[model samples]
Target: MKPADIDEFFRRLAADNPAPKTELEYINPYTLLVAVVLSAQATDIGVNKATGPLFQIVQTPGQMVELGEEKLRQYIRTIGLFNTKAKNVIRLSEILVAEHGGEVPRKRKELEALPGVGRKTANVVLNVAFGQITIAVDTHIFRVSNRTGLARGKTPEEVERKLVRYVPARWKPHAHHWLILHGRYICKARKPDCPACAVRDLCAYPDKTSERDMLEDPPVPVPAG
Candidate 1:
């Protein structure tokens, strides 16, 4: 997309939702870290359902250590990788208690050192919990970036880098949430609602689907904008 298109695209998104936030529910950075770690390959709704009960009882590293791996599995068993995730959650909690004084570390390297906390998880925690501008390119964001031609790339890292370079500085803070929500609800993988898309005119996907008649076209300048 051109500079003007990219600028207006994010401007409209920010205007629509001034203060977008992660769908995952958490009380603090500690719980946010755990929620992001458990959210891999799972929906926000599913994670929130499990964590709602889990966090009530185990909000801190010391509390999580007391909860134990076996009981943790019982709470999150409905999730995709409960067995492994339970083990990692407990192990990381112990690490936090021993190393970081039971607080979620602010630095990405320290967060990544925790068990089961990968690049994406660390990025999410760093951004949403710590007020960082980093983008955690989840599947939804990755798909949207490629499909919209907003920051097209074959790999998530490439798309992330391109987004950092392309998106205006003013929009960087909440850009991740805007794109992710848009992909999840509007620019869907199966059949995009092009007619209702905010950036349909700017999007360059060749096969963008729309509910309108094929012969009809959206308003634009004659031959050029």
Candidate 2:
């Protein structure tokens, strides 16, 4: 998309949600990191449902470690790959306690060094927890970026680089949240709700679906009586 359209796209999204936030619920940075890790290959609602109970009991890295991998698995078993996620969470918690003094690291390198914490997860932790302007291009952001022509790229890293370079500096901090939410609700994969999209006018996608198109015909007018 053009630079002007890019700015307008974000402008509308920001206007709709002045204070966008991560859908994954968490009480603190430690819980945020764990929630993001468990969110891999799972929906935010699913992750939130599992983490809700888990976070109430385990806030700190030490507390998570005490919960143990097996017990953690029980809490998150509803999510995909729970066994692996549990193991990684437990190992990362151990590292956090031993090296970082039981605190989630602010630096990307340190965050990514932890098991189950890749670049995307590290970016999320840095941005959400540390107030950094990093963009973590998950599937949602990736689809929206490419679909809207805001930042088209083959890989998430490429899209992230484009978004970082193109998105206005003023909107950088919250760009990820805006794009993710838009993709999840509006610009969906199966059928984008183009009629309801705030930035539909600025969107460059050729296959924009409309509510009118989904219906056989316009609704008949109601009688005055």
Candidate 3:
């Protein structure tokens, strides 16, 4: 997409969701960090399902340490890779209590230093937990950026770099949420709902679904994010 179209693309997305937020539910920054770590290979829906009750009980790092790894496994057993995820959650919580005075670290390097927390997870925490402009290119953001010709790249880091460089300053704060939500509901991986896409005309994707398919198959009701 051209610079003008890129700006307009984000303009439409911003209009659709003036206050976009992460689908992951959490009580505080610590819980948000844990939720993002758990959501790595799993869907937000799945992570939220597991974290719903867990967050109520373990809202802080010290509480999580009290819960312990073996018990944490029971809470998140339904999520994929629960065993490893449980261990990481417990260990990271322990580290937070020991190193950060029981608070989630704001620095990217400090966030990434925790177990199960990578650059993407750190970016999510920074963007969602705090008011940061960083965009974490998950599968959704990666596909949407490339598909719409907004910021094409072979890797997530490359796409994030391009988006950071190209996205206008005004839209930077919520760009991550807009792109991720658009990819999830409209520009889907298997069959994008181009007929209902607000930025369809601005999109450069060649394989956009036909209007006829909209009538024949019909679009499912998109759940509220």
**Leading candidate by lDDT:** 3
Residue 150, candidate 3: how far off, in angstroms?
0.5
Q: What is the C-alpha lDDT of each candidate?
A: 0.86, 0.89, 0.90
What 10-residue stretch in candidate 1 is worst by lDDT?
216-225
Clashing pairs in 2: none
Best by TM-score: 3
Best-first order by TM-score: 3, 2, 1
lDDT per residue as tens, model 3, 85-191: 99999999999999999999889999999999998999999998888879999999999999989999999999999999999999999999988888888888888
Candidate with better TM-score, 1 vs 2: 2
lDDT of 1 at 223: 14
Which portions of model 3 show Cα errors greater than 4 Å? 215-217, 220-225
RMSD of each: 5.9, 5.5, 1.3
Ten-residue stretch with the least lDDT total in model 3: 216-225
Every model's TM-score: 0.92, 0.94, 0.96
Count the clashes in each prediction.
0, 0, 0
Q: How accurate is candidate 1 locally (lDDT)?
A: 0.86
Candidate 2, run of 10 with poorest lDDT: 216-225
Residue pairs in candidate 3 whose N, alpha carbon or C atoms collide under 3 angstroms: none
